[model samples]
Target: MKNNILNSLKNKFEQTKTEEKQIQQYFSTFDFASNEISESDRMFLVEKEQILIKQGKVNSDSLYQICITLLEVSDRFKNNGERKFMKWYEHIGLNKDRVSELLKRAHLYINYPEKKNLISSLPTQSVKILTKKDIELKEVQKILELGYTAVMDIKNNITNLNDDEKIKMKSFKYFDVKSIQKIQKDIKKMDSKEIFNAKKEIEIYKKLLKEAEKQLEEKEKDYDNQNNLKLLEAE
Candidate 1:
């Protein structure tokens, strides 16, 4: 029964027009295979930190929430700053573990700060440290290159596919022909700005698909209800 209620709520939320738009926007920007973050991207991190500092020292709740938001946004781009943020967080007197956990829930990475003082106090040395800028950029470049290769492989297979195969491919609508076409176009252009735009567009499409699925589920439920009512009347 609890599951049913939860499912119902999910269906309703998904069916809403606003939810549909939000989902479309989300998928349009989806870049699942991109590099998380590099050291060169430190400017982004610095900007975020500045925002936190500007927020002024408030009650513990507000401070923690803002920190979590900054951490969450950074993590979404694969630039997890939980450890560094936590170092500063503890310096200001917050629940280190709870804040760390919350950041994880928001899809950020978890690590212990590299500060010798923090390390000495920690129970374990196995904790991963944040990657430096150069290391991070290299990692990003490698991941992007690998993503390009995968896209190429999929493109080759897709081109060879017959009508039956193409129809079967609809099961993975997120990677449909249109998406592949855009990807190929971006590759040909070989511009970082264009690639970023293309990636954002793909994310939007995925969000739209999610919204459409939700709407379809709601319609299915309504249809089921009408059929059930008719059957009861006939009986």
Candidate 2:
């Protein structure tokens, strides 16, 4: 009986491994950006994107493929214009902002196909920030070396600081009340650009705080209901 169970488990594990390999192969070879776009190819890309979204487990490689697929079809969706591709992405369960980000990254990757491995090595947020405008490969490397806080500073138009100052900015927690108060006290010392960036950070924090409060309130309600059900069951 033990031998039979062991063989069954081994077979299942192998099967799963094989399936993963096949999926990876498919993504690798898929003609995601073919010039000769046919209806079947279009549908294939759409189905793959839908599956990726449904699985809710998108890593960097899969995300890169998704961007390529969207960038390809986007041209045909809105009178064959990529600029108007925003409406169709909503149908595929992506918000406008997310679709824009993916498209920008795709454009950057397509423009510099040689740097794909380097691009893929970075975080998705970092990639999004890097691709917001026309940037050189060397510039991307420089910003990456400076680290996350520096990248965020660039995102907010805080460009006057040196590398050390940019790196030091990461020490403060964006959502900490005490940190915000300290920043407030030091606001008078900041340049105009730094002031603008700080205000933007505060605005983002306020939005996040509201979202966290909402989620917490919902969880508390769920906890209370679960407790009430337990009390009734114990009666």
Candidate 3:
């Protein structure tokens, strides 16, 4: 029984590996951006990015090179900060705050020099964990229209607010941490069956989303061609 279970797991793992390779190959040859060469170039750049991330995982030398490249690129387009080096990450997304944090992390490693091994081994997504459990009530009022970034950013500044308000914010944050930790612990404890079901649900959701996109494209293909649509942004 144990041998059978191990074999089953190994087969699943190999299947997942095959799927990932298939995805990468499909994207490599896919004409996702045949219309705009710039978009096609972006795909290759992102592929290099994934390779850098995988390399950075095992080798400190690899990480140091990545950090150096990122920091240099950031500085090269110093004036065009957001426009040049912005990509979305969940929770904090790729906003000004995340950019600031990336620069700060890169500089810390650069200045320390010796800490490159430790810093590089550390996952960048770990930085996104620097979030409060809940936004302060006053912060809730101020950050309403802002997107997910606002959801992550809670103001701790007690400038104009009273002592009672400060205490309230602190208490809320304390509770938030405790609640989030408990939820994460519960999630980690889910059984294999539970985890499998969750993953199956996700696969179903992804297939449905792709089907919807396909249907929409089919329906609008003529309309889009006729309209030659371009979205305008107002300064």
Q: Which candidate leads in lDDT?
A: 2
Identify the runs in model 2 with alpha carbons over 4 angstroms from their true place.
1-61, 77-84, 134-137, 141-235
- Give lDDT tens digits, candidate 3, residues 20-60: 78557643444456656586577776687667655654456
> TM-score of predicted model 3?
0.27
Better by lDDT, candidate 3 or 1: 3
lDDT of 1 at 163: 57
* lDDT per residue (tens digit) for residues 1-235 in model 1: 9999999998898768674574344322323237566554654555555555334322223423443564754465556665676565455444544344334322212232222222221111111111222224333233223332222232233333345532555577445566576677769867888778877987997788668755765665465345334423543
Poorly placed runs, candidate 1 (over 4 Å)? 1-179
**Candidate 3 residue pairs that clash:** none
Could you tell me which 10 consecutive residues in candidate 3 have the lowest summed lDDT?
226-235
lDDT of 2 by residue, 1-235 (tens): 9999999999999988996776665443456567676878777776676577435433445556766887888766747554456655544456665566667778766866665545544444556667644545566555545543233445544353445543445465544457756897998799999989898988998788668655665665465345334423543
Candidate closer to the true structure by TM-score (higher is better), 2 or 3: 2
Cα deviation at 195, candidate 1, in Å, is 1.7
TM-score of every candidate relative to the true structure: 0.26, 0.36, 0.27
Q: What local lDDT does model 1 show for residue 203?
A: 93
The lDDT per prediction is: 0.44, 0.60, 0.49
Ranking by TM-score: 2, 3, 1
TM-score of 2: 0.36
